[model samples]
Target chain A: MTYPKSINNLISNLKNLPGVGEKTAERMALAMIDFDKEKLGSFSDSITDVKDKIRHCLICNNLSEEDECIICKDKTRDSGILCIVDDVRSLMLFEKNNLFNGKYHILKGLISPSNGIDPEDIDIEALINRVEKEKIKELIIAVKPSLEGEATALYIAKRLEPKNITVSKIAHGVPMGADMEYLDAITLRTALFERKKIS
Target chain B: MTYPKSINNLISNLKNLPGVGEKTAERMALAMIDFDKEKLGSFSDSITDVKDKIRHCLICNNLSEEDECIICKDKTRDSGILCIVDDVRSLMLFEKNNLFNGKYHILKGLISPSNGIDPEDIDIEALINRVEKEKIKELIIAVKPSLEGEATALYIAKRLEPKNITVSKIAHGVPMGADMEYLDAITLRTALFERKKIS
Candidate 1:
């Protein structure tokens, strides 16, 4: 028998989330019954509040509540060196491990022609303008090592070429602690090609 | 760099969902930025609406919008043949495949002593009472074939023994389309023990 309308509605809406499918959505809907009313209220409020309050950082395209994001507003972080990433998640990843000391520019998307996402569709022009206005010394493209990520990085580098700005993409090779047998040909090839000499 | 307050709140709230960990919650919260205002509003409403509108059916403990669940309200189903299931999920699974034509009684909880749950905590009394009041002739215990499920089924059967009710547990065997190589020893033993001869 079909679930009541309310439950079915929840299942459908839950499917809207990334990586959530029908079975997972059903599980989530069923699990909700165990949650206390107060928790549910806060959870509901949490989802709604983000939409109502959060917006883009006018400067760097990072998600923010105010006009400027936390990073943009912070004077402590060095702003001269800008690290470009695909989205807020990538920006957060770089921040989490204290890997990068420079400020960030979130593209919020990458170039993928198959998905109809063109170079102009993303925030490339805004990035170029940010570089010029802020007098950024270095642009480090730290997007994931995917085809689309490479395309976006290359496109951005070409755009900044005329302005005589230094553009560098993050190194792509075998990851740390990865098993050699499991490494794909492309990664192994790239690792060898970009290998550093210790002599 | 930390996300703004709104994003951080959403991330924590998303973590409240079953199977969603810290990283997944962060991913979900970041993904929410792609959702439009109207979609976000409805998604938020969908979560809250279920809590407001849904309740347990007094008769069978199935989740419902009204006092009685859809299955309990149906007069066409065979009320005499009652099926005892672990929860609404099991009830739905049985109903989905047209596997059972009988009425259902949701236990909602099983006899898991390790989890500090006992027979006294579950709705077994309601189930026993329903069997007598409704004159249920056959009780098909269809709970999952697990330790807690067996204990629960045994407890219910023993309780109803004096009433002369015909209580039967569903068979435990290797499922259809299952590969023999991947089958666990217990399942293989069960399949062999419960095997039916065609000769």
Candidate 2:
């Protein structure tokens, strides 16, 4: 009886979002109330709308409100140059840099054997079909540098090799401006071994 | 063309939530891809559902899915005792403690002239009406001891002084089990000021 039922309900609903624990949700609910009744109502509506209306594009499995996302439908994108990533977030990070004109294929997940996530469970089959049908000239693997990411990249690389398509990986090395002395032995070795000749 | 349109839209929607900034929203969007797609969809839906289904209770401006929230509808709560809180989050915190058995009235905000918030902006009138109609015996102010909170409490006390209602503020002093040596000057002063005679 102390809390109006709606306030409690809103707080509980907020818990559904990532990083919103109970205490944080409560704080958020209070903040919403402070914004005025109308805004509080909007906050509630927005939460539900995002959940209901937003979905992954069926083709690329990227967040979308339609069947094919904007990137997939855009004519300006070079469909032949595909960048494969472990999640939709990585694609966004790349887009923020505005350096790539290629299309993206979200893997949805990596081959995490410890967690029982296998490559077969993700959209690998769709990726293969996309490569074949879309006449993709290059498949650039840009997954994280974790063990699972490396394994997934390798799996995808092997799959694409049979079609005679160019399979490349974004190089993993010390970040820009990082000192060479601080670099780990394995990374330093990889960077040295894969060094490209500067023309 | 850079970020899939759907992903961008979804991230933008996420940014509207309480405590969600651009960076946090981006991280959450990416994390969503790692979770079950269906669950992510449902999480978004829940937000909209809560917004549409819930509203403020007419009597107390507390959150409610119905015209009157669960607390307002309940027959068991002591209507005579009303606990006044500056924000709805305080109500949630008290609910976690499970100590109070009375009803609650959320002010929605505290009186803060600096931030352009005053008593008129909140549900102060509704609070007075509830007190009058219910013939409440004790009104316990459970707001924080912040400058705004203190100012709000003083304002509410003055307004209710004419009503002959017994108004009391919650205690503010050293937290239980906290060492006195570790306590700052403000807390020490509050502890000394709020000292109760023990038998």
Candidate 3:
């Protein structure tokens, strides 16, 4: 027999999330059916609250409740340095690790011509504007090293060249704890090209 | 920087679901933030509706929106035969494959002395009551082959012995498309013991 209408609707909605398949969504829906009314209500409220309150930071385009995100408003962070990431998720990864104390600019997406994503489609103009207005000494291109990511980084670097900002891409290499024998050729080549000297 | 309070709360709530970790919940939360208000509202409504409307079927203890589940209400299905499953998820799996045409009984959970789950913890009493009231000729115990499942099935079998109902456990053997070379000793032993003669 088919699931009830409400359960079916919830499963369909859950399938919209990344990596959630039909089986996963169905499992989630069935699990939710066991929740008490109060737990379910609070869960529903959280979903609605996120949609209603969360918005992109006006300055850096990262997720925020107000016009300015927490990173953009923090005075202690190095405002002179800005780390540009592909999206808020990537920005969060850096934040979770406490790896970067600088400000951030979320491009929201990359420049993928095949997927109809161009520079104009993302928040490139805002990155340029932020550099021009702020006293930024360095711009770290923390975008992934894919074709689209490289293209977006190059485009941004060229635009910010006239502004005299030190635009640099994050270093690429074999990840720590990775076996050398299992390393892909492309990664090995990139690692060789970007080799650093040891004392 | 940390996520805003609303976003953080949503991520934590999402993490409470089975199999969803911190990273997956964060991804889900971020993805939901991109959903339109109308979509988010409908999604939230679906979550609350499932909790409000869905209830265990009175007859079989399966998830349902009414007093009885769809299978229980369907007169075309064989009422004289009942296929008992461990939970609603297992019932759905059998239904999805169209493998069973009989009525069903959802045990909700298996008996596990170690986990403090006894026969009283699930719907065993309801099953006995239904068997006594209904014209059930064959009772198929389709629970898993784990220790708790076996004990629960054996207990059910013993309970129904005096009631003159034919209680049978689903066969335990090597699954279809499985290579016998990789089969474990216990599975291979069971497969050999339960061998059937070719017609």
> What does chain B score (TM) in every candidate?
0.93, 0.88, 0.93
Summarize candidate 3's per-residue lDDT along B7-29 as a digit string, tens digits: 98988889878899998998888
lDDT of 2 at A34: 45
TM for candidate 3 is 0.90
Tens-place lDDT digits, model 2, residues B106-130: 8878889999998889768888888
lDDT, candidate 1, equals 0.89
Native contacts matched by each model = 0.83, 0.32, 0.83
- Please give the RMSD of candidate 3 to the true structure: 2.4
Candidate 1: which pairs clash? none
For every candidate in turn, the CA RMSD to the true structure comes to 2.5, 4.4, 2.4
In candidate 1, position B85 carries an lDDT of 89
Question: Could you tell me the TM-score of candidate 2?
Answer: 0.75
Provide the overall lDDT of each model, using Cα atoms, as 2-decimal numbers. Answer: 0.89, 0.76, 0.89
Superposed model 3: Cα runs more than 4 Å off: A112-117, A196-199, B113-117
Query: Stretches of candidate 1 above 4 Å error?
Result: A108-119, A146-155, A158-164, B112-118, B195-199
A79-195 per-residue lDDT for model 2 (tens digits) = 889998877668878888887888889886888889999878876889999889989999889998888888898999988888989998898877799988889988987788988
| DockQ for each model | 0.76, 0.28, 0.72
